[model samples]
Target: MEPGAHISARDNVVKHDRTDFEVPLMEKDFAELLPRGKMPLANRLPVLNLFNQAVSLGGLKAAGAKLRQDVIGCNETKIVVVDHGTGLPRSCIAF
Candidate 1:
């Protein structure tokens, strides 16, 4: 998937804000995006497992867990979630 594509289980489509693009989320597309040999196997395995679990359980929950684990409230990038259809910000997280 392209950067900036919103993965939401609440919606049937993956939405991209910049170009107002919408596409169906399919297993093939996700499988093709998995990390390959260029990445270390040790690093890749956990990520692949997480990705598979996310696919099986649904995206939002898995993403939330990852965000909570990774976000440390440091002076770095900010992560936010917004209402995709309305373009309204819902929550902001800084790290």
Candidate 2:
């Protein structure tokens, strides 16, 4: 893991069939991509800082399917998702 080394979702997910404007999923190349099949504007999720923090913590697969979407977005190259999570603890404020 060098400074400029590459970080990718390759180890976590696999490369499968998808279109130009899509990201590859897991296994089989491995996974699924729910309808509403558009990668949300990266800034839309609570994941702004620590996305992985909750994307799957609730087991909501589609909302958290970041790999494939990333594969395509990066042109199947680098898998970059700045998931640093805001160190401040957060919870369901109203719901």
Candidate 3:
């Protein structure tokens, strides 16, 4: 992750403005966003790596954890909301 973008995310959280995450929390900011210099071949939410999440964070509770505003707590986890549900094509990706 970029130092600037990463810290900017934390700063936004500190200020408690929680709605600007259209893509930063999902698509482009996770990668080199288009405006960062290179044009994207396609704009899409990056797929969730289930294997990675499984290894790193194991099972999630039946209910998702809350969306916390703690910038420091961000290092541990950032559960935005309970997931949409199972079997939907796009539901698996969280950011």
Candidate 4:
């Protein structure tokens, strides 16, 4: 669910891009990322939840959504930006 992670659907086509997703449209984005035009609802719901949590957090959510560069824009969702100095584990977290 991160930008540039090389995700593949169970049917097996690779996603076309590696950018953060904008909400409302996020469902659509997830659909597009799938190989068979059939993304599992089970997987999608949690991602939306994550987006909702970010939105509840404030400005960081807005900035994260800004990465979309779309007029539809981001809502209350939070965006986290991190670098090499962040000190968190690289395996379990997203920057």
Q: Give lDDT per model, in order.
A: 0.50, 0.39, 0.34, 0.42
TM-score of 1: 0.19
Off by over 4 Å in 2: 3-25, 28-32, 48-95
Per-residue alpha-carbon lDDT of model 1 for 1-95, expressed as tens digits? 33322444344365445445556567554544555625446523333243454232345557766676575333237776656654445566764
The alpha-carbon root-mean-square deviation between model 1 and the true structure, to one decimal in Å, is 13.2
Q: After superposition, how far is residue 71 of candidate 2 from its true place, in Å?
A: 33
Query: Order of candidates by lDDT, top first?
Result: 1, 4, 2, 3
- Rank the candidate models, highest TM-score first: 2, 1, 4, 3
TM-score of 4: 0.17
Highest-TM-score candidate: 2
Residue-pair clashes per candidate, as listed? Answer: 0, 10, 0, 7
lDDT of 4 by residue, 1-95 (tens): 53322344334355555453434444345656676778656534333234565223345557655755553332335343323333222332222
Q: List the residue pairs that clash in candidate 2.
A: 23-68, 23-72, 24-68, 26-29, 26-30, 26-31, 27-30, 47-51, 49-85, 50-85
Could you tell me the lDDT of residue 92 within candidate 1?
65
Better of 1 and 4 by lDDT: 1
Q: Output the better candidate (1/3) by lDDT.
A: 1
Model 3, span 1-95: residue lDDT tens: 22233334433454333454444445445345455666544433243343444322222321133323322233333323322332112212234
User: TM-score for every candidate vs. truth?
Assistant: 0.19, 0.21, 0.13, 0.17
The collision pairs in model 3 are none
